[model samples]
Target: MIGFFVITLGPMLYSLYLSFTDFSMLAAPEWVGFDNYIKLFTNDPKYLDAVRVTLVYVLVSVPLQLAFALAVAMVLNRGLRGLSLYRSVYYLPSLIGASVAVAVLWRQMFGSNGLINQILDWFGIEGMSWIGNPETALGTLVILNVWTFGSPMVIFLAALRQVPQYLYEAAAVDGISRWGSFRHITLPMLSPIVLFNLILQMIGAFQAFTPAFVVSGGTGGPVNSTLFYTLYLYQRGFTGFQMGYASAMAWILFVVIALVTAVNFWFSKYWVHYDD
Candidate 1:
């Protein structure tokens, strides 16, 4: 416990200290009080852009990913043949989804001469630069995020199984159609699980790094369209050696995530129902 405290709390304290200073890797840090935070809020356009991009990415990707996962989970819960095999096949992507190899493959697939454009060409559509255009680059990342919904799908499958069989039978006896049974019975029971997945996916989306980093060739290019908050922080701290500013950005992100999680928890009380 002492070691855990030291390991976790020590770095957090160090980062707090760093956030108040002007530190580069080469020079000793000079205490600048609230200058970093002030600059971040007042003068930094890039920081604002990062915030917008992060929020959009999280809001758009997480819900879409969860929705797709729930849909797939419902399909998988139907007692299909080769259930285990199908689950394994769907889950394989999530296992390797964030790896460098997969990111590279994504880059190639979204490139101008990539498979996507090739298919579009077969339909007589002109090939557009998917990753080279600022408007569509972030959208591509959102699609990549949706494609890795397998992990949440598996979780939803487990939750779906735990739903009481008697509820369905009761609904059927009352002349409820299959859709009505699902809407009235399955949905209410699944609400808590959906909330759980939403929080996890939202947090994960905020921290998304590898796909954007690799897809943009480490440039956050196409006019910074894919410059996620974490990627921007990485460029500042590691690439530019602006440790103090980066630490400030990191703390801001921590606060934002905390606030969002707290809000979710507060909202859950009204909607998330547990059987017991």
Candidate 2:
């Protein structure tokens, strides 16, 4: 509790106070009321662009990542040989995907003459500089996020094991098609896990930074297309020395994440099933 207060709650409360000031990190903080927050919304085009890119990143990556994870989990749950080894192999990416080395490797792979283009060349198809183009830069980051689906895949595998086999057997006995059984039995039973993974992935996606930071060379370019909110916050706080403004951004992000998570819980009542 002392550690939490010193590290987490203390810094949070300090930053909350700092958000209402004008601190350049070189001088004392001067109170500014709501000017920083208001300026971000009303005067800052780049801030709006960051918000737009982040929302797109969250919406697009979370669902796709969860779906891909669930599919892989279902496949691996089908009594595969060397199950433990396979699980570890699949789970490795999630462990390293956010690391600086992995992000650097990703940038190289998506470069103009990188492995991806080499593969396209083998197919007689031309490939552009994926990370260099604003249009496709963010999509590459989304793909990177999806590639780290191993964590959720592991969660889903555990949940799938807990689902009683008798349910599937009974569905088969009732002459239900495989798809129908999956839709009726598997889905309803897995709804709670789905919600859990959805919320987890959504929060993670919202906080994604390393990939964009490395791939875009900390600029969130080629045109601010990949300017994630966190990256912008880092720029403001560290790179540009606008700590107070960055604090405002951080608080806004905190509120946004809380609201989103609350909405997910509120909506879960309609679709997330529980045995109780």
Candidate 3:
């Protein structure tokens, strides 16, 4: 327990402490009070832009990702032919989805001369630079988020199976349509699972870095459309050597996520059903 505290809590506490000071990698940290936070809120347009971009990314990606996952999970739960093979195929993306290799592949696929534009050309549409244009670059990241839905799909599958078959039978006896049964019976029962997925995906989206870093060529580019908060924090800390400011940014992110999670849990009380 002591070792665990030293390894995990120690670094976190140190970073919290560092958040209040001015530190570059070269020199000892000097106490700066709330100056870093004040500067960030007032003077840093880049930080504000990063925050806005990150919120947009999280709001768009998390729900879409969960929706896609739930849809696929429903299909897979129907006992399809070659179930094991299909499951393996679906799960493969989640395993390597965050890798730099996957990001590069995504970039190639979305580039002007890539497969997507070639497909567009087949339909008599002009090829456009999807990742190069600011309008479309963020959409590409959203697609990437949706593409990695396999993990949540698997979780939803497990939750779906735990739902009682008797409940469906009861709904059938009540003359409920399939959609009606799903809405009232399935959805309420699965609300807890949905909430779980929502929180997890929201946090993942908030902290997303690799896709933006690799796909944007490490500039968060095409006018910072892909400039995620974590990526910006990395640039400030490692690239610019503003460790103190980066630490402050990180703590702000932590607080934001905590508040969001708390709000979610508060709302869940009204909707998330527990049979017990």
Query: Which candidate has the highest TM-score of all?
Result: 2
User: Please, what is the TM-score per model?
Assistant: 0.97, 0.99, 0.98
Error of 3 at 14 (Å): 1.1
Candidate 1: tens digits of C-alpha lDDT, residues 153-252? 9999999999999999988889999989878888889999999999998889999999999999987878888999999999999998999999999999
lDDT of 3 by residue, 1-276 (tens): 998899988988899999999999799999999999999999999998999999999999889999999999889889899977887899888898989999999999999999999999989999889999999999998999899998999999999999899999999999999999899988998899999999998988899999999999989988999999999999999999999999999999999999999999999999999888
For model 3 the TM-score comes to 0.98
For residues 1-276, write the lDDT of model 2, one tens digit per residue. 999999999999999999999999999999999999999999999999999999999999999999899999999999999999999999999999899999999999999989999999999999999999989999999999999999999999999999999998998899999999889988899999999999988888899999999999999999999999999999999999999999999999999999999999999999999988
Q: Assess each prediction's global lDDT (C-alpha) against the native.
A: 0.92, 0.95, 0.93
Where's the lowest-lDDT run of ten residues in candidate 1?
Answer: 179-188
TM-score of 1: 0.97
120 Cα displacement, candidate 1 (Å): 0.6
Better of 1 and 2 by lDDT: 2
